[model samples]
Target: MTVSHLFMQNYTGPLMIALQYNDLFDLDSISTSTDTDALPNGRAFTFIKAVQTVNERLVEQNKSDCLLFEVILISKECSEEIKMKVDESVKHYGLEIGKFFFCKKEELINTLQSNKVKLFLSTERDDVYEALHTGIPAALLYDQADDHVLNQLKVIFSGDVIGFSEDSLDGLSEFGFSETQIETIKTAKICMKEFAVLIGQMRRRFGQENSPLCTCVLTSWGSRNVCASALKTLREWGLDVDEAFCLAGAPCSPILAVVKPHILWDGGLLNMS
Candidate 1:
């Protein structure tokens, strides 16, 4: 007998946060203790309080990793005013601005389709329409803003990443985290049996957009060696190294397609080769 799947089975419960090329960036680890040094940073006014609460719960219950920059789509040339506002909000919420890459509109149209990029808060509604027509998830940044492409950012802050989209007011949804809040459960890949169980669960929780569970392998690999090789490769590709990271972790599995993921990484030049 064919079992019909439920309509909201994918996101009916708790939501997940992850990325596609997850290993490329290090996820945030938010500590919400009122006594923690970072608590002051999150005091900035934003709707990220619910996410903060969720992170607190994760730290208490399952030690889940927090997000850094969940990748926001925006104009490369956003206004200074809007940029300051968004930037302050991010810092107030204890979020970091890892890096920004600029893509020309025409170039984007050619590349975005293959990349399966979601249409973002942008100044060009026509481009937004084009992106949406391609079956990508696109949306206007906000209600009022300049119509120019380079002058307006229509900032889409990563803190706006929501775990649940339920009924809301003030244009924000209530966070759905509850006693059943999802957390990253630790499972060792040391043994075949343990490994199989971990993989099975990854399959089950893999596709949902808001799935909170994430898996990563920890290894004793030399950071200097790996980072040096990476620097060489990138430089060889004609890219200058403004910053480098020797992150320690195994290659992680990609997240589901529906929920586009963003990454945040450190800055500074590295000569650890």
Candidate 2:
């Protein structure tokens, strides 16, 4: 069955709000006034209100269709309370929803394909590319002047990291993120580029050997593009690698290919002894 999935690209603020406050207090809890400090961050609370408004709009627009909303809850606030709140929110709004959480790199791509997600609420350009390349329509969830990658996507509303694109990764002097996010992206990009190079080198070395391990990476479902790009660079470098292969029914699509040769070793880098 060909299912067209629609995912909301999560804005960090609203997502954080949904996790922190919603998990702690729901309509029932809030109605009962049991938790006064339920919402710790005022900004997150405001963002939640805005998100609810958007959800209401979605309900109004698709009144007749069976709306299945898939939310990728990739935040630091992954607690039982957050989970309950996310589930409750969807149920309360009457939306059929599938939710996944990520704190690692291997699950990003897997989730995208499994969901068959057509639209996104996450503004991460790399994540957007993961969806786009896999045939999903992605958009920014909020607005910001600093999001250069918005041009690369069908940007909806925008704010914070949800506004950034690959282009936003460049020109750190003028990037919108605070020093912390900028540093985080900078470190991650460096690691990503380095990982790509390492994989490429490994492929080359494996091709020269007759007894290479038939190995496959169980990559993160949500971060498939970064891994894919790294693998692609490996292929381009003339390494015969069986690409990162995922299990059947897994969210991550596994790439199975034979490794090629002609990869030059630099300073005995390929020797694992």
Candidate 3:
């Protein structure tokens, strides 16, 4: 089919996209390094192509204005390359590219809110989920065949309060919990117990044992209950950890969420969809 036809088929919402580049995946000319260490990969190229295709499709659909664009620096080097390429490409296409690099998470959120970005695009699912929970429309792109997780995310972005799957529930058992308990946690509306348990476990695993461990909980923005629950749970888990105090009502980056070296626990109840 034609480009417009393809664009029409994929997305119906305004597209707010974040660019990711792994040097291995991006073209050499388009890639630059902002840091001393830069590892290029094939994934960067894949995302670049995806972004171009998506943008082209948006233009074809006459929804180009709906496609907001930004580049998140996964690495210092990768960030610089992305900025250079985005500048060149936008001019070449006569497209108004979104801001170049977001060095801090707060800046990124500000840009999104200021621009009223609707849909987010990135190869990272973790970032997408964070954005979705925060009331932003998101389009996630990941190589892993995580359909179960993706389905949950789709529901969340569509305004669902919680998202879960049996498969995801099953995955949680690794952290310690029976099948029945896992199911219950998945359905929790307020997320009190789950937060407590997650923090508790992390304390025991990291704080008490001195293991090289850190805890990160992705909560819905403005969900005071979830944040409170997470703090309580961690304390009970015996972790002498201070809450780093992630913003409760900010958009999250799905891609960055997964890459961080921490085991994520969904200490919330699973509701029936």
The whole-model lDDT of each prediction reads 0.27, 0.32, 0.39
**Can you tell me which runs of candidate 2 are displaced by over 4 Å?**
1-36, 39-64, 67-103, 144-273
Span of ten consecutive residues with least summed lDDT in model 3 = 150-159
lDDT of 3 by residue, 102-161 (tens): 445545545555655544455454554455455554443434232223111110110112
**TM accuracy, model 2:** 0.29
- Candidate number that wins on TM-score, 1 or 3: 3
What is the model-wide C-alpha lDDT for candidate 2?
Answer: 0.32
How high a TM-score does candidate 3 get? 0.33
For residue 226, model 3's alpha carbon misses the true position, in angstroms, by 26
Runs off by more than 4 Å, candidate 3: 1-14, 21-44, 47-98, 123-126, 144-273
- Pairwise lDDT winner, candidates 1 and 3: 3
Candidate 2 lDDT over 1-273, as tens digits, reads 111111111211111111222221233443443322242222122223333343454445555423322334444334565555545554554432335454435565555455444334343445543443444443323322222221111111111111124554444435243554454443433223322233333223334333222223322221445445534443443333443442222332122112111111110111100
Better of 2 and 3 by TM-score: 3
Candidate 1 lDDT, tens digit per residue, 80-199?
A: 543344444455546423333345546555455544342222323454444444444433222221122211111111111111112211122123323211110000001112212322
Question: How many residue pairs in model 1 have overlapping backbones?
Answer: 5
